[model samples]
Each structure stands twice: as C-alpha cells, then as structure tokens.
Target: MPDIFFNFLACPLGSYCPLATLNRNTGICEPYSYQLPPGQPSHTCGGANIWSDVRSSSEVFCSAGSYCPTNTEKNHCSSGNYCPTGSTAEKRCFKLTSCNPNTASQNIHAYGAMLIAALATLLLIIYNCSDQIITVRERRLARSREAAAKVVKEKIQARARWKTAKEAAKKHAVELQGQFSRKFSRKRNITVSDKVTVLNEEYTDTDGNSYPSHEHSTSLVSKKSQSASEVEEIGSSPLMKMINEIEEQTFDSSESFSLEIKERNLKTKKAKGKAIHTHSQIFKYAYAQLEREKAQQQQNNNLTFSGVISMATNTDYKKRLVIEIGFTDLTVTLKGKKKHLLRSVNGKIMPGRITSVMGPSGAGKTTLLSALAGKTVGCTISGSILINGKSEPIRSYRKIVGFVPQDDIVHGNLTVEENLWFSARCRLSADLQKQDKVLIVERVIDFLGLQSVRGSLVGTVEKRGISGGQRKRVNVGLELVMEPSLLFLDEPTSGLDSSSSQLLLRALRREALEGVNICMVVHQPR
Candidate 1:
C-alpha cells in the first residue's frame, strides 16, 4: 500500500525524491523513517528527500554559492550579483561592493562609508547654519543698540536746546520789564515835580521824606546805566553767545528743524499707541521715561541731603524683606585635623548695608564668607548662625542667597548680556514676567556701566574681548540680576581701578537701599 501511494506522489521544492525499500519488521521504508517505498526503479534519489532528522541525507541537500528552485535543479549567480545556499534568486551588489559570479555575499564596506559620509555632511550643514544664524542675530542686536543710543542723544540735545532758549528768553523779558518800569517811574517823578513847581510848594512823603530830588535822580540814572552795561556784558558772555548761536542754528538750518520735527512726531506716535515692538524702540522708550523721571526728581529737589536723611530715618521706607546674618563664635576646623581655618570669628552682617571683610593675604576672609554662605567644604563648622535673630541654617533661605566667588566664573563665549540673562532666567522666580526680567537685566547692565560692552563677548584668554575691569563687573552682575536677598562677594574689587571700584560700590549701595544684605571681602580699605 505504501509503494502504491509513493508511485503517484512526488516531493515538492526544497525536498527530493528517492527510492526506498519497505521494512518488514517495522512496516516502514528502509534507510528512512515515516517515508513510503518507491514502486518504480526510475524513482532513485536525486536530491534530499527525507525530512526527518533521524534519517537526514547531507549529500542530497542544497549546496553553498547556489540555490535550488526545484529539488532536482540548480543555477549559477550572475556577475555583479551574489547568492547564498538555497537562494531562489541572486541579489544585486551595492555600489562599490565586491561581488564576483557565484559569490556567497557582497562586501558592505562601501555601504558603511556612504552612510558615514551622509552623516558627516548633515552635521557640517547644521553647524554652519547655526553659526551663521547666531552671527546674524548678534549683528542685529548691535545695530539696534546703536540706533537706540543715537535716538537718546538726539532727544537729549533737543531738550537742552529748548531749555537754553527758554532761559534766555526769560532773562531778556525780565531786563525789558525792568527798563520799562524805571522809565515810567522817571516820567511820573518829573511830572510830579513840574506840578509841585506850578503849585509853588514841595512834595513831602511819610516819615518826613522828601520827593525825588536832583541827587536821587542822578543816582537813578547811574543805576540805569550800570544795569544796561551789565546786560550788555551778559549778552557778550560766552555762555550767552553759545546759547544765541545754538538758537540761531536751530532756527536757521532746515535739516536741523526737520530732524527735530521728526523726533517730535515719533514721540507723539509713541505716546498715542505705545507700539514699542523692536528692541531699539523699547530701549528708546525706557530711556526717555527714565530721563523724564530724573528731570522730575531734579525739579522737585527729591535727592537733597535733607531728603536722604529723612529717608534713612523713616522706618516706613524699609518695606522689602530684610535678612540679617549674625554669627557668634564662628569656628571652622579642618576635618580630621586640629588646624582651624577660622577661629572665633564674631561679627554680624546687617540688612540694607554693605559689610566689608578686610584682612591681609591668607587671613581667612574668604573662609569667613564661605562659612556664612554655607559653602564651606571638607570642614567641621562650630558656631551659632542667626538669621533675622533666629537660629536657622543658611540653606533654608538658599533660594534667596547669592554668592560670587573671587574667580571670574563666567562663560567666556557668552556676551555680557547673555551671561547676565542666563543667570537671571535660571535664578529668578519661575513666574516672573519676561518684561520684568528684561527690566532687571537692563538695570543691571546700566548700573554696572556694561551698556557699551553688553553685546561684546566676555572673552577668554585665547581671544581678547572686553577689558578686565568690565569682565569683573559682568561677573558681579550675574548675581545682581537675580535680585538676591543676601549677597556675598569674595574680592569683588580685586584688580579693579579706583573708578571701577567706586562704580561697583555705588551699584552695591543702590542694592543695599533695596534691603539686600551684602557682605564682601575687600583687599584694599580705600
């Protein structure tokens, strides 16, 4: 029955047909399990037939470098193509790939190289485009700043001219009024004396004072001449001459008049819409407002010594939060050693004041600041640090604390504005408005006198940039932009000239007015 079944049956592709004899004991085909016997002699093995692992035929299986479409057929791979054992079709080789006829596989080194080239090209394009974009943005910002500065200068000049003209006109009007009053009085006196002569009597005044006499008349004429000479002298003075010249030029020059008119129109537009969109416009608006405020303060005499004394004495002016740091018996000892970094340091830093820590080299000024700021490392601190007269860890208010190291720990690649802006964004309150943040950054830049160098790079040793003094101020500005409640500085004025140091101190003094608790280490007492 198995032979009859095998006579009509044929093996499919990937398999082979073979002759087999029946096994009488097991009732199965001989030399193979679960295979039926072939009835005809023509049915001989040509390829692999048995599919069972127990009776596999390696000699009849498909060979390498070739494939079998049928169990009894085989084909060679064509040129520029590759094929592995049992492949039904050849594969075309990749470009630059090595593939000979009847090859088993194509080399992939060319594909890897192409992939690497593509990736490198992509990276190069990205880098170049990014650099170009940054350069363009910086240029635009610089131009904007220059335009703003120019506008501010023009506005200030126009204001000064107007003020000078007003003052000169007022002086001239006063002189004319004085001369008119004197002439009228003289005529009236002469008329009264004529009337007295006609009546043949003398005019007497209260307290037995006589009427206008010859000596009085002569004195009055002399005073008139002197005042006229004084007026002539003032008109010939350099200041008056300059004022007159400026007025003449302003009125005579069409270009100057047109420019002034344009400025007025721009101001009117600004006031009507408040459409200050660009950086230059914003800067111009802000500066104009600031100037107006300054002028108002000057006119009001708000910055007088008496006003300052009153502001200092008034408790209501201290509205911001005050942080007072008082340390008693502060001692910092090195771990596992008896040596002390700071011994018995007793002092307090008050709010709304600048406390200077002064000492010679290695006198532990930095150490004391570090200890107060809670930045001491690898040391055992033993002391009572009181915050607002209460014992508390400095870390509790670390969010409001700022520490500036002696080293200029700033990004050399970043501009002064960028460094300060990054610090402000990261350190300021998360909910702060962008306008407020911009205001803070601009204020810091203006106070530090970094306006000129705001767009310039902070610079590295390899690439020279702003001066060392400006860089140092930028370093301080980083912390100032954060509006810290308690600020600590280490050698902030170290390497600064006298003028730069004074500027820095003035900025710090302004901060102190805002109730910031400031403590800094200074090498020079002056």
Candidate 2:
C-alpha cells in the first residue's frame, strides 16, 4: 500500500500530471493511477520501493494499492518479487507495508501541484493568443472584401459613364457630319460635262427617236458669293469671279442664236437616225452597260458551277449512294402525347439517278431530306443510312454530299459575278489548284447559257429583270460549284412557271447525262 500510494501521488521528473498534482497553496491530495510492472513479483518488491517510469502505464506517479495503471499484461507485477519492508530479501512486494502520508510527504505533494498549475496557465495564454490571431485574420478578410466590392462598384460606374459619353459623342459626330455634308452639297451643284452628252448620242429609243428635244438646252451657271463673316461681305474667291465672267459671256452669245439652236435641236431629236447625244441618253447608256455586265457575270458564275460538277463526275465514274436517306421507327412527339408529326418512315437515294420522295403538303418529304443532311430534325431515328457499303451515320456522310435548298439563297444587292467570286473564295479550299477553279467556273457559265446575264443583278433591274429560270439556275449553280458527288435539291420547281421549270429540269438531265448524280424534289412535273 505504501509503494502504491507513493507511485500514485508522486510526479514524473520532467512533466507534472494534473490528476496526480497536490496544490502547494491548498495542500490537497489529487487521486491518480499508480501502475505496477510484471517484472517484479509485487509492485513494492524492489529494495528501494522504486518503479521505473518507463515500465509504468502513464507518467503519473501514484501510491501503491490504488487504481493500477492499464497496459499490456507483461508490464504487470509478477507473483514472486523482492519486498522492500521484509524480514528476508526473498519476500514479494505484495507483502510490503502500506504507505502512510505525513506532513513531509504532503509538503512535497503541494510543490508538484504548483508546477501543474503553472503549465495550465501557460496553455490558457497560448489559447488566447491563437484566438486573437484568428480574430485579426477574420477582420482583415472582411476589410479586403469591402475594398474589393468598392473597387468593382467604382469600375462599373466608370464603364457606365464611358458608355454614356461614347453614345453622346457618336450622336454629336453624326449630326456634325450630316451638317457638313449639307453644306458641301450646297457649295457644289451637279455638273454635266460635254463628254457625258457625247456618250449618250449613240443610243436610240424603241420608237427609233434619236434624242430628247431639250438635250442641249440645259446650260451651266456660275455664281460669286462670300460668307457673312469673311471678305468684308463683298469679296469672292478668284475662281468664282472667273466662272461668273464665263457664264455672262455664254448667256449673251446664246440670246443671238437661241431660235436657230432650238429649231436645229427639234429637227435632230425628231430625225429617225440622229448622231447627237444628250445628258439623259448618256445616263441610259451607262446604266445599260452596267446591266449588261451584271448579266454576263451571272452567266459566267453559272458556267463555273456546271463545269466543276462535270469535271468531278468525270473523275469519279462510280455509281454509288453518295447520300442514303431513311428513317426506321422514327417519331417526333410533342411535349404531351397530343400530337405526332412524323412516324416511322424509310427511303433511299443513289448516285447517277434521281430518287423522288413523293407525298402531300405535310408528308415529311422535306423532313427526311433534312434528316439525310445529318440533322436531328427534332425526331428520334432508329435506323442508319449507309454510304459506300458502310453504315455511315447520316452526320458522317454529310461532308461528301451537296444540298441546294428550296429558296433562292443570294445577296440581291451584289452583281452576279460578285456572288460567284464570294462563293468560290468561301467554299473552295485554299490549296486547290488555281487552274482548276478557272476552268470549272468558265465551263459552268457556258453550260448554263448565263453569258448574256453574267453581269446582271439577281433582282429586278431598270429596263430588264432576270427571268425566274435564271435565278433558279444561279441557285443550283451555287451548290454545283463545290463539285459534290451527291446532290440533293428540295422543291426545285415549286414556284416557277412551266417553261422555266422545264428548262431547269432539262439542264439537270443534261448534267446527269454528263455523269453527274442529281436528286431533286418537284411539286408537279411530266
């Protein structure tokens, strides 16, 4: 008991245990676990009643016979061991006398208690310091967030102010430019030169009339003036003075010969074949040239399209399915089960032949075409389309095929040649041989009989509007320029007249005979 009591009550050398402490100020005992080892028969069997701290359960030292410290069985006291308070050295530790505390033992216990109290105080100080540091970090983060928000708000305001300033400046600049333009126009009136009138003299009207009666009557006038702020309100520029002098001399000379000039003009304008030209005639002739050039350009572009297709067909002489279109167990269902647009449908297309998918207004003919173009078409398609003996999911084969849509895809403002040039540049790969592009474009123009309207606009012109057939040809031409083996046309003759439609189909047949695969959808055809 004495050995166990001392072991439970005493403190380790380097560290103090809170549970085994004795308050030096209060002189109180703190209950703690005192451990025994298995090496010695009894806990207090050693000669000096000493136990190694390394063999004990915890570092706490306590008196013997109290709650023993827990550890592996090997560390417990053995049954036979030497006793400290025994008559012979052979007696075991369990036979030893119990420890009885006295005033001296209590004093030592109080000293250990003071050391433990000091350690606790130090731990509390460290905890306080860490909490303070965390608090400071939190405050800094809050301040940083506030500063960042302020910066973002300021930036937003700056951007808004900049945008407002830019808009105001743009409006002011446009107004200033408009004012400048009006002032400039007022300073310079329309001037007609003799060269303009001479160019117009060659053209004759439908009635075979040579020119208008007032072709030569109009004359140029010159004025001399000064601004309200400049030149003392009297002086004009020297050039203005010279023009004014010439106008005066011309006006005086015209008065003497006015009657003769009028009669001669009347006779010349009325003549069946007059050689003289007027201002209006010059304008008409220039406009005609512009129209003719436009028509020729369109024709040239059409030839380009046809020529390339012919060349591609000649190169690839195989008759295969460039595009195979079908739908198996296909269905398009709306949000609710209320309506279904397309049901399970199937179709196929082969090269060197035309396969027509016929149906009424809402028969999904166009929808199937769109599906073949490698689009979802807002439907579920179970089957696949095969290309060149391989099941090419529709999306994969779209690269090789060419598609011409129903509507005329064109920029009405641009001339015919401009359209073809843009298409060639956009669609043709940069690495394509240049000679091929030239030959293909030229051949297309000649094949489509577009030489006459090669330079014409696709839309209505002043004296001549392009025929519906020609516009359709250009539409077809745009696609043919790419030289795809498989071609798909949607509603090729939907809104065209019989004659125009026939001409277009004939062109398609001619292209097919030349070994180009053609496929098109038509409303009604013989």
Candidate 3:
C-alpha cells in the first residue's frame, strides 16, 4: 500500500462517522488508509473529479477546484480563492488579496510633506519679524518713558515759577507800602507857599494833557495823588495782569494798567448783561410767567383756567395780576375749597388794560390777582378764566401770561444789562440770537432808565440798592424783554413815591396804547 496522508476537509457532511471512506477505483493508485494528525482526513471516499473525499464517511465533501458529479452537490468558495494552511490542511478558508505596500507608504509620505511645508513657513515668518517686533516694543517703551519724564519736568518747572512769582509779589508789596508812606509824608511836609508855586508851574498830566485852570489844576493834582495812592495800595508788580493770566510771567511795561481796567470794565459789562433779574418785579414777573406757563400747560391738556399776562418789546409795557374785592366775581374759579390763610383774600392786580390794581389793604386785591395769575396759594378757587377771549384753564394759559409780583426781583450781584440779557436768554426764543439779545438788552436798559446803572452791580446801588422806583421798572423791564403777549404786575408801584409810580404807570399806559396788554397791581398811586 502507498503511504497515506490526511487532509482536513471542510464540507457538508451528514451524520457522524469518525473517518472518511476511501475509493481505490483509480487505475494506478493502490488502496491506502492512514491518519497522520488528529482532525485530518483519513481517506478520500470517491471522485469522478478530484474532490469528493470527506473525513466523515456519511456525507460528501468537495473542493473548490472540483465539479460535483451531481448538479445539486456543487461547491465553490463565495468571496476569495481557497487556500489551505498548515493549521488547516484538510480544509480550506478564503483569503483576501493584499494591495501594493509601496502605495500606502506614498500616502503617509505625502501627509508628512504637507506638515513640513507648514512648519517651515511659520518658522521663516517668525525669524524674519522677530527683530522688528522687538525694536517696535522697545521704541514704544522709550516714548512712554520720555513722555513721563517731560510731564514731571513740566510739573517741577511750574512749581518753581509759581514760587518765584509769589516771592516777587511779596517783595513788591513791601516796596509799594514804603513808597506810599514816604509820598504821603513828603506831601504833608510841603509848605503852603511851595504848593502854590507847584500849582503855578506848567505841569503836564501822565496823559500829557495840560491843566485847563487853577480849579482844574487842583483837581488834576488831587487825581494824580489819588492815582499814586491807588498804585501803592495795589502794589508795584503786575499783580493785576497776573490775576488775568493763566500762567505767571514778567509784566510788560507797554501793557497799560488802563488796558487791564478797560478789560475789567468790559468783562463786568458782559457779566452784567448775563445777570438774572432778582428784583421784586422779576419775582412778580416770574410768578406771572409761572402762572401763564401753568395756564398754557393746562390748555395743552385741553383744560380751562385763567391767569395774568404781560407782553412787551423795545417799549415799556405793564400787565398786572391783581385781586381786589370784586375780582372773585370775574370769569375764573378754583377746583377745590379755599383756605383763607394760605391765600390772599383781598388785593388788586393791574395787568395791561387794567394796568393798575389800586386798592386798600384787606381788599382781597392781591388774592384776586393771584387767583387770576394761577398762583393763589393755599386758597380754594372756583370760577372760569378768560384769556385771549377764550375761557381756558389757567394751567393751559400760562405760556401767554407774563407776571411781575410786588417785590424786587433784581439780582443783587448782577448789573442792569446783565439782568435783561439773562431775561432774554431764559425765554429761549429761537428769534433771540446773540445780536437780537444785545439789542433787546440795550432796548430794555434804555426803556427802564437803567443805562447809567447798566454796569453797576445791583447790590451796590447807592440808594436802597437801586431806588424803589428803578427796581420796580426793572421788574417790569425783565418781563418786557421776552415780548410776552400778555403781562401782569402786582404792586408795581407799591414802594415808589407818587411821581415815580406815575412815571412807571405812564410808561405802562403808553405801551398799552400800542396794543400790548398792560396790567399793574398798585397799592397807592399819585
């Protein structure tokens, strides 16, 4: 018998015979039966082709390379070529073919190339810019340090200059005091005969103007002496100039003290033009304006009320809000009950056409006017008010009414021009531009006879701080500056004597004739 080797065959088999059956029907082969390893095929059963051997004899097995003798018994691998291995010799399993290894390596090599290219670009950029970046950073730091140093130097220099200026001022003050003392002493020691000789001599003033006569000469001498006294009192250094400068420096000889004075005067004039009127009339006017504003606001809401009204322009006008014994019966009323203490029961209001509310005390005159002006404090009122021929609520009617109460509303610190200019500004009219404001101020000043006191501080007026009459006119003047269509005045002539009151009323009456509604509340009138 020939030596036999077994192949583990994996194929459909039926039942469980342990060994495969052999067929010795081939012409040149001798029968063989052997098992070399466990799980190996012992024999081939039969085959018309080469693969009918199976380890289990009960069923048929087939190899991939062979055709079944019967069509129903055909066998073949599904996915790949069948290959046998040492671990599975008698049987076969499918194996997938491999791709070229060189192609896979090429893909990995391409990824590495991209990464290297990016890294090289980044490194090159950094290498080229590093020095420039460092230089820019260093320059920025240097500039910062230089700026800080300069600021410190400037601060130190400013401090030094201030100290020097202060020292110089102190020294100058001492010199001025000495000069003043010596000059006074020398003048006192001069004999009467020597004074006469000096007066007889043709002496020129600092301005180079000759003295006109003996009396004029004496006056000039006195003026010169006063000027000298003023110089000493103020000190010799340019203290005045220093006062005006933002920083300290030496005074210029060509810079005249008179120029400084003129500048001061101009400043004072400008300031005066900006002052708010704080006189009795202004308060009265503000009160009236407040009432008018109140009425107008109410009207804006479609409510009905009444109040005092005043209006004026370049000409003087009067509008008075007065409450008298009979004013309660007028076409106006309060929304609530009246409280007598919080309200004036009796007073007169003279506004425009009714330019004078003249009545005795306790006449409910002021109360009536306050009621009309929408300012009856602590008082219950009931009635309708008519304005512009309409029975509008006082709150809605405020915009049209201008009121001046019976007190001085002139600001004590402001000049007359300042008062009017501020008055014009406060109204905030689109028409009241800078030029219009100046003209308005000028007109008001002239109208109220305030030109002389235009530059005078209201606080320093000699007699009663701007005569009661002038103060009253200013009260009215402030209101007229706005050119309100309606105006009110309360006790406008209260403190004025007969003539002043008459003049004030006459001015108001004249304005009334020109179609400006004028009203005044006067306790007494000439």
Candidate 4:
C-alpha cells in the first residue's frame, strides 16, 4: 500500500488559509478566510486573511496602510516607498513624490506643482524674448528706411542740378549764337560792299584821274578773298566757342543723367511687377512716386484755371464724399456768465476751398471752430448747422471730420512717423489695406516736410527733440493721415515762420484740391 500516505496542501504565500475546509463541488477550499492565531490553535480569529484575490466578505484581503509579503506576514509601508492593500512588494516613490513611513500611496502633487511652475517660467521668458526681438527688428527697419530716404534726397538734388546746368547751357548757347551771327554778317557785308565798289568804279570818280580799273578791281578782289578765307579759318567766335564747349559738356552730362534715371525707372517698374520684399525696393517705389508728384505739381503751377479743372476731372483718383458745412445765425454764449463768444455768425465752408478766419486776440475764432466741429463744452449754441446742404448734426459725420487744436496735441515719446502711423491706424477705415495706410502716412510726412525728423522723437518739456514748428506740422499730420473730408484747424501756423506757414498752407491747399472742406483760423497770414 505505499505507506498509505495522506497529503494536506498548505496555503499560498500571499494568502492566509486557516480552519479551511474542502468543497466537494468546486474541488477547492471553502471558508479559508482567517489567519492562524499566534501561540494558539484557535483563539478569536479577529483579522481578515491576506490574499491576492478575494471573492466574498469572509475572504477579505489585507487592509490599507500595510503590506503582506506572505500568508502569515505583514509589514507597515517603509519610508521612500508606498504600498496598497494586498501588495506583495512596496513601490518606490517617484521624484518629488511624498511617501511617509506607513503611507498607503505616493503623493505626486509636488511634482505637478513643479511642472506648472516650470511652464509658467517658460511662457514668461518667451513673452519677454519675443518682445525684445520685435523691438530690435523694428529698429533695424527704421534705420534702413532712413538710409533709403537720404539716398532719394541725394538723387533729387542731382536731378535738380542736371536740369539747372542744362537750362543755363541752352540759354548761354542761344546768346552766343546770336552774337556770332551778328558779327559774322557784319564782316561779310563790309567785304561784299568793298568788292562791289571796286568793280563798279570802271569810270573815273568826281576827283579821280585816269586809272587802271581792272587792276584795282583785281587787287581788291584778291584782298577780299584772302580776308574771307582768314575769317573762315577763324571758325566761331571765342565766346561762341566757349558756349559750344559748355553746351557739349552739359548735354553729355544731362544725357547720362537722364539715362540713369530711365534705367532706375525701368528697374522700378520691373520691381513693381514682382513682390517687393526689400526695404530698398520699397523706398525706390516711393521715390518714383514723389518724382511723379513733383512733375505734376510743376505742370499744375503752369496751368490755367480751366486747364486745372479739366485735369482734375480727368484724374483717376476716386472722389471722396463732399462735406459742405453751412451755418445760419450761429450764436454761442457762456452758460453761466451769459457772455457771447460768437454773436449770430453766418458763414459757409465749401468743399475744394480754404476758408480763413482772421481776427485779433480775444476774438471768437477758436470758439467758432469748436462749435462747428461739435466739440464745444459748457456753452449754449443756438443756430442751425447744415451738412451737405441739409440740416444734420456735425457729429453724424464724425468719422469723416477732423479738428486740429491750437496746442500741439501729440505723443512726446513717440517719433513723428510713429505718431502719424498711430493716428492713421486708428482712424483709417478698417477695410483699408496695409499698403494704402503706409502710403497715407508717408504722404503726410512728405507733404509736411517732416522727412528729416520723421524718426526723431516729438520731445517733451523734459527732453527736447524736434523744433516747435516741426511739432506743429506733426500735430496737423495726425489728422491729415486719416484722409478726413471736413477739417478744422485752429492756429495751425501760429508759431511757425513765414516759410513753414506757407508750407502748411500749401499742404492744406492740396487737401482742399481733393474736395476736402477746410476752415482754419490764422492770426497772421504770409
């Protein structure tokens, strides 16, 4: 009988099985739920057994805050490690994780917090670096534009010099040619008369004796032919020779200069057909446009009134909306003091014209402008204001209106171009293209003669920058860049010299020619 052996299986390593019974149906142990009591066969069986898998309440696994490595062994979780219930081995905590002794699980909140802090720091660094990069790029572009503008100015000067030299040479040549013709004709006449006299004297004169007329005539003819040959050898007169030399030099220079200009223009046209990706190309286009405008202005200066009207009618420029402002019995009075600032003033500001309001100190010029612009405060205005020959509030067309104050209202810290650009960006139509906006700003800069100081700061009281006259122009430029249809200016030329005042007026005149209604007050006109 092989010793009649009987084998009893023990519990697994990770589970406890005391007081177990075999189930005949399932062929497995039943009620293997309690651990063996220490130092006794069976005491109270207080705690549940440790097991990898538990199916019923009686077969509960190990509790939390402890780990079980074997059926009969359990240990509290160690430091730097965490253990869940029924864990066979402790898990080491990750970096920045909190795992105290006897802890159930690792705490990874510190890692999450560190990750958030690092992300925030990275974002801040990116923001600052991006801003610095943008600033540096803008500064480089500004320097490039200024250099290009300087080159354009030099080219303009060269063209002017060439034109002047050409004109002077032409005038001097004409004068010299006239003088040489007169001198040569006088010499020829004297020689011809002497020959005729010698030939015609065949008979004796009143006091002449019998003489050899043929011999005298032959000798005189020989002398006359010799003098004529001598005159022919002399070529042109000395003055005429100098004039010819100068004309040749000037003509050659002018031709070369013209050729250069033509080549540049061709290059510009070619560049225009393609995309302008460089600052130099952009400035070249601007220079070409400026040259065209100069030519147009010269033509306009020589045009009669009818010719100007016809030319203006034939231009391709899109007409802006006309704004004609008329006021009837306009009266403004102080609210509290009952003092009349404007007493029943009547006037109309028409499109395509400049209306100047001149008065001494204490006059109501500024007050009237403010009232017309619908910016009057603390005053009672009683009148009817008409817009486009209809009774409409001036504020209705505020978007198309502009008003320049007596004082220069401009940003002191920003450059002149920057100031104008800001105004144009804010006030120009949202649908306008970026190139068009740039053109408007540049046009204002050129018209106001602010190119030299475009990049210079407007300056504050603390730090001086451009002159007062330049600042005044910049102030007006702010409004001009917006392409307003109705403009009101208060003392725009007050602090400027005669030339600056004339320049401002000329710019305004150009605006007026574009169908803008302009009304300005001036203390003194130049």
lDDT of each: 0.75, 0.52, 0.52, 0.78
Give each model's clash number. 0, 49, 103, 0
- Candidate 4 residue runs with Cα over 4 Å from true position: 1-77, 82-91, 96-98, 102-135, 150-274, 333-340
On a 0 to 100 scale, what is the lDDT of residue 49 in model 4? 32
RMSD, every candidate, angstroms: 11.7, 29.2, 29.7, 10.4
The TM-scores, one per candidate, come to 0.62, 0.37, 0.35, 0.62
Q: What's the candidate order when arranged by decreasing lDDT?
A: 4, 1, 2, 3
Per-residue lDDT, model 4, residue 42, is 55
Model 4 residue pairs with clashes: none
lDDT of 2 at 318: 38
What does candidate 4's lDDT look like per residue over 1-526, in tens digits?
1211211223454444344554556533445433444476454433233332334332344546667787666778889998776676788899878899888788999988999999999999999899699789878877776687788788888999987987887787788678867887888898888767764574445247656557786788688788777666656457657777877877788779636535655775575577765766666566557666667667677998876676666544326789988999999999999999999899899998999999898888899999999999999999899887899888889999999999889999998988998999889999875545666777788888997898798999999999999999999999999899999999999889988887898899889878899999988864
Identify the runs in model 3 with alpha carbons over 4 angstroms from their true place: 1-352, 460-465
lDDT of 2 by residue, 455-521 (tens): 6877744444477777777777776666666777898877777766766665565455444556677
Preferred candidate (lDDT higher): 1 or 4: 4
lDDT of 3 by residue, 1-526 (tens): 2113223333333211223344335322222243234354553443222223344331333333332433234333222223211111122332223223111111245556778999999999999999699668756644543454455456657987987877677577557656756866675556444566665664544236755467866776786687667656655447444443422333542456326534644654564466444233222323333333334345434523321222223122223232222233343334464334223233333333555666678766666667777786545665445554456666664655678877778787776766777888887476543544544554456445665666565664554456556777787888878765567788777677776666566556545544556565665654
lDDT of 1 at 151: 88
